[model samples]
Target: MGILVQEDKGLFHLQSAGMSYILQLVNDYPAHVYWGKKLRSGSNLEGLLNLGGNRGLDRLPQEYPQYGTGDFRTPAYQVRLEDGTRITELKYSGYRVVEGKPSLPGLPSVYVESAQEAQTLELTLKDDYAKLSVILRYTVFEHTNVITRSVEFTNAGETQLRLQRALSASVDFSSGDMDMIYLAGAWSREGNLTRRRLVQGGTTIGSRRGMSSHQLNPFAALVKPETDENHGEAYGFSLVYSGGFEAEAEVDSFGMTRFTMGLNSFDFAWLLEPGEQFQTPEVVMVYSSEGIGEMSRTYHRLYRTRLCRGLYRDKERPILVNNWEATYFNFDADKLESIAAEGAKLGIELFVLDDGWFGKRDADNSSLGDWVEDLRKLPGGLSDVAQRVNNLGLQFGLWFEPEMISPDSELYRKHPDWCLHVPGRRRSEARWQLVLDYTREDVRQYIYESLSRIFSTVPISYVKWDMNRCLTEIGSAELPSERQGETAHRYVLGLYELLERITSEFPHILFESCCSGGGRFDPGMLHYMPQTWTSDDTDAVERLKIQYGTSLVYPVSSIGAHVSAVPNHQVGRITPLSFRGDVAMSGNFGYELDLTKFTDEEKELVKEQVANYKQIRSLVQQGNLYRLQSPFEGNETAWMFVSDDQREALVYYFRVMAVPHPPRRSLKLNGLNPELDYILEASGEVYGGDRLMQAGLALPDIQQDFVSGCYKLKVQE
Candidate 1:
């Protein structure tokens, strides 16, 4: 489960628990040999590199193909030399293997707690005439069938160079007979599963919104045409970046496919001076021979433990009650207190005062960048209100859109050029807000200082860092004209910097990232913020698909799901409270509605829901997930969570719109110990694990629309 080098044959084999990736230096050019099931030790890997015979560079499966160098496919990178030529060749110069994975500079990547857990391979390629050196890094962990890849480019020459397109990683498959699956949607409908067969041309998915747009995620998977959740081979690619990104799957004339993922080259360029270097973000690749389910579990575990950090990474998230949907911009100190008091009576642990607490901000159109408390709403200020909420035996949280500015704000009035803009053009507006030019050091410093001030005095326990809009009129005021194209990427880097400072300073605060809900719910944000608001659409019927699709790449712990009032604020669907609670409990459970407005009967039901969640949240947050049915395939959705020791499990099933005169159905569970006997907690019925898995457990008759059920199982000792 480590890297093996056949130095004589110029072959490098990176092996994980269940997969292997082999590449060979053929004539000083690295060519991909095999990437699939693990091969036996001392396998004839050299012969595999020559299986297709001596072919042109265009046809060979290259580890990192170049443009204008015999190969005609998309280059892994393109650089504009001093002489204005975009052609360059990189030949093998040297290589080294290390015991630990090295962190990428100023970037967020999966980390290793100990050096013995993973092995890294650094292969150096040099363009002698251009004086360019590129280092391709690959790391394989001992316990997972996952390999991460990234690239670093250094200008070793005395002359300056320009990087036009620098993608992180690429892979070529021998055959194009596969299906490409990705997550796509917009706003409230984020993370909808979309799958299509590979064609002769290229199929691309990306985000150019200066943020990882909700329209498409920075992830994709390719599987055989016959692959399903439980069977067949699947190769997954995910970019560990939050800004504009592109993932492409290209099929050539001879039925060969090449997949690439990294920063979007659109309006992107970097200037590398002599002795300077540029490091691209990391791309995580997973090879799952057991199917898409296994691939998803690999990603979920890796990101949940290694990528997400801080105090809350492994802890069970508190059941929070956010006041955004309840009061919006109209809440006063009294209104917030009432909600907190009612939530405390029920089992909610945290009360979040969302939006409208700053400046004269009565609505979304004003007072974004101004962080001062609105004294008119709270006569004593934020400290007083936070103390009042804390006195109710609940933790207090605040919401901030630190990266946005309202045109009517004092900060914007003082510095009109603070927002992203072009000199001659009128700035565009979304949600009546403009994105702050984070590329400017002054802007980031001001935001940091402003947030730090509040963090020091407010006794705040959690923060909802919200960005309501995307980047527009993308020009930074501090950058020179020649570096204007670097605005978007620089902005992302600045965001990471600010996040690192703020999160590090206040390590105890639980931060959740939101972009009008689920817009920026990528792995990059999860590095600093452990969880993300799954979506703005709190309708249980809608969340059935949203949560289900999100589980493909993100862990259940990283999803912030909430029970909102009905008709839901976004979808206006009138779903039952129990149905909403069942759906929301699958994630970091919370409530987004006004608890003070609940009737006595409703209050009792909420209490029960909260208690039940408290009992099972540990298993839900850290257990292995097994999806039995997909909402995309039918009206019914079923999923389960199993403890690591296989002694306990939780099963949830939902019927969106119950069919009339439906046939009896039973769900077959997975990830259970077939050798043990289990007891159902609710009915006290005993059944063997083999019977529950093979013969299945009968589902109850739910005749109403939007109904759900939960079953808990414990192994009989």
Candidate 2:
């Protein structure tokens, strides 16, 4: 259970029963080539702080050249351990270059980058040795979840070194069974308004391959750079930054997987002459039972369970209907109030005024962060509309993109340098807009102050925090030379910190993340928001694919779905109102369509659907889910749910295509109390469970239907 020591390498960890892991570390790495620590670990790890195991290296000098810090205080190397229950690792972050220490040419003779220096003061420098690149002490808590690893690279000596940064980790994936050979791909893209991409199966969906690495299990790494000649090599997604760095991420991996995250983009060498400070990219791996969606859900749980226990978990989510797909940058406040009045009549929760509320946001090209109410459209201040809705028994919600500014807006004119732009370099204008850098505390403060004023003044129940673009041409002319690449990493961290502060101060207001639909749909955002808009696509048919893919990991409660009108604004496909209600039932359900346009009967249907949702919210939100047939399988897909008590179950079978002829009997169900009598109440039609569930029983089967009417099963004890 403990580490043993030797003279050369500081420590050797021994595996023990139920021990879960063996991590050997040599704290002082003589050199500073950060990208390839794994290949260099066995030779460079030289510092010593062993837990209980023997030091594997030949004993070296206390201030030996072998055990020393490099130019930047980045994490040296790492070993990851995980079971279904727990994931843990030992790693280090902060490293400062000290003067007069052991120097390596222009590098420091000896350096110190301890876990304590990084402000993770809770960690103990349990073990270290001279092995690979500089290996050393780290906290066991770092790898406990989806957080990967973080290394702070401080310029210790007086001279700046070439910053060719690439961050990676090593994992011993000794699986008890055959390792699930998964093809590594990234749905990730930088936040640049000018660029957008999707990569699946290690190949970019529409363009050339983005960054991804090929793993040889705990060993070789074949990097598929953006400039790689071979376009089809199966590899893990790797993003290389040849310039200034910035960005924060929570990584997750399976079997011998290293969720390597880093910020590159630093084309020029950092000019850290002396007394200059900087930090390497931070990588944290979060754990989730499912995949990407759960990866995001875990972040939310961490915020709730770990960080903000005092913060009440918001139970009453805002029931705001968006006007994006309903009216799409059209309609005035009077028109909005008419719709809000109708929503209030249905016990509809909140009335939200979506986009087109601000300056020239009409066609998605301008008015991103122009918070002023569009007088041309609204004819009245936004608060007038909010007050009107509040009086009508509905809470009001507003949309804002404070992190972005359009060229057509007043904010961009005053502070043109506020964005992440470099002088003389062409900047990307995604959707004809740019992301305002929040890396600067001033920018962060501006957003905080502006939104706080609006929210505090009004009875706003929710705010849709939307990020419509990704980063391209990332460079902050505001930062110093050594810390320039820091914009990306720092920007992301700044965002997290900003959200933390804002949410902490205003705990009652709900924030829903809207990243150009679902682009920012990850654990990172969930840490700040109660729910995310499932996708920008309000089309019910497209939503099925988007929501189905989203649900593989995330709880249905975290997904935000709406019943929008068809010729679905995104994908022109009109579906039944009943079907829309059924699909939206799984998540935080609401409707986005203009209710004023619906008939009296349809309004009554909305009322009925709302009531039905409340009755089964417990079942749909907190039940064991099973996919009897995959949506990707065939013309029809079936899914079932059983409550924790095992008494009630609901099955949904949808046939996308009509069958020429249908069978007379329904398919037999499973996971029921086999010996108990049952009853089926489907669409208010009741049938005895024992008779309906009997094998070969002749029962009425609706010829393959897409209407997700429930087939309820109640089992008697």
Top lDDT prediction, candidate number:
1
Q: lDDT values of the candidates?
A: 0.93, 0.50
Give me the displacement of residue 519 in model 1, in angstroms. Answer: 0.8
Tens digits of per-residue lDDT for model 1, 480-499: 98789889999999999999
| Poorest 10 consecutive residues by lDDT, candidate 1 | 45-54
Best by TM-score: 1
Error of 1 at 589 (Å): 0.5
**Model 1 residue-pair collision total:** 0
- What is the lDDT for 654 in model 2? 57
